[model samples]
Target: MARHSFQSAMATQAGNGHVLGYTVWNHFFRPETDELHPMGITQLNRLVRRSWREPLQLYVETAHDLRFDPGAPADYAKDRDELDARRMQAISTYLSVVANRNDVNLFVHDPPRAGMSSDEAWRGDKDMVHGAPRGYLTAEAIAKGAISSEAPGGFPITLQPDLGGAGMAFPQPPNFGGDIPVGDFGGDFGGEFDVPPGF
Candidate 1:
């Protein structure tokens, strides 16, 4: 069924005590259109029929980037890896919380296995190589004082780059020509300094 209409029906059910609330799965997208329309009666009826047995549930898509581009930089690769790691950790933490509370059911499709094309990978055929949605859940936990650290499995968690100044640094490549004169490198790198013997 078209997602909007399904959502509307779910809302109606919630209002009438047919259900408490519903969860939405998959990416949210709206086609470019001036007016929104509801799903067909057949689809709505099918959904309502299933609602009798199906609990309110939502699906969380794997938040991983699957496409590979050969031209990406080394820095980008490193940053992407770090970001994915953090994301997965967050998801783990969130799952842990949900399990503890037993209040809501969260559904996630298994990621595809390794070595698959992006299109095939989207079918849950292979695991993701990058871009997992883990960190946000951990971040929310931390903000709510639910978790002391962002680490999953009870391991020590280091500061993530987004957390503050962690992993931040000024690029200081080796001065192959030796240190340039302070006058030559003015502004931020400027100031009075003793000249080297050679200079």
Candidate 2:
């Protein structure tokens, strides 16, 4: 699924001639499901190397923690912490190889903390993982500015111009022609799962 999504984004970049960036969430790798354990990282490395060969910029947000609910079990929290550490380590290793720290830039979300209650965190009304919308907004804005060269203070930026492009162009995803299915909603939706305009 990650590969497909990454390829799709690359294809979109190809068509639009815009830069590509990604935010890799820490929880995306489920220890129970072994999501992106080693193989996924390998594939991602290949994709990054391929994309790095392009003249465009590539931004990546490394694994970041957003506190999880333990539901009163201390052991569960401990296990989750351990699993998160391993995933972070794997990503760190991958970045060491693929990330040049310049054109292939790297950034991270704010460190996880008890900034909100478990209930609030679960609701994610403010942000995706924590109820801190301000921080998310600030981070997003800074990243956008840095990518567009319209703002400064995106630290750790070191200029290197000698780097050149190489590697194969990423392939586009296979098209399965059809409108996406939007499950049943009580309200009147347009035909074939299409949302009504101004919805």
Candidate 3:
């Protein structure tokens, strides 16, 4: 679905036992729409049929640029960090829905411990991507995820072959940028699923 579609899902699910909204760093491999990433809520809502409430989850990317506010024409909620705790509070909302303990994933790529190489990465250390400032899904927050993993320091990233998990599974945590293949540039990517009864 698109931005409108996503918001419709959230607003409908809001206060209904599902999640209200999610905190974010405003970055990701957003499927290009008009040569740009579509709306987050819209994207999430579109995948409602494949959603799993038992572990109904969403990813929150963070980086330094997450400190800024989003522009107008908001499809759903606003991406603004007018205050400090509110930022964290936004994330807290996601936790509330899942009823989990701060299940936040910090997708960052700093020098010492960065998960991104393209300075213009959506969640890079401090770069502008698609007219939006880089976000902060801090490494410190990964542990908060339902299942957090990391590629230790200095492990060159490599997009060996995760072909949507056809038959290959990563042995270790995923580093930001290895000499791998696929993805925006070239890194380990893709998450697959089993085919249903019939395609």
Q: Scored by CA lDDT, what does every candidate get?
A: 0.37, 0.41, 0.35
lDDT of 1 by residue, 83-195 (tens): 44444344334434643322334454433332467886585632332122233234545466653432333222332334432221111221223477433343342223332
Model 2, runs deviating above 4 Å: 1-21, 25-30, 33-35, 50-72, 97-199
Q: Model 3, 1-199: lDDT tens per residue?
A: 6999999988776743333233233442232111113454354434333443444454343333333334543421233222223434444453456434343432222222233466556455332211221122333343355222322332222223323322221222332465543243344433322233212
Arranged by TM-score with the best first, the candidates are 2, 3, 1
Best first by lDDT, ranked: 2, 1, 3
- lDDT assessment of candidate 1: 0.37
Q: Please state the error at residue 175 of candidate 1 in Å.
A: 75
User: Which 10 residues in a row give candidate 1 its minimum summed lDDT?
Assistant: 27-36
Q: Candidate 1, 144: how far from true, in Å? A: 84
Best by lDDT: 2
**CA RMSD per model (angstroms):** 25.3, 24.4, 23.6
* CA deviation > 4 Å runs, candidate 1: 1-72, 101-199
TM-scores vs. true structure, each candidate: 0.19, 0.26, 0.21
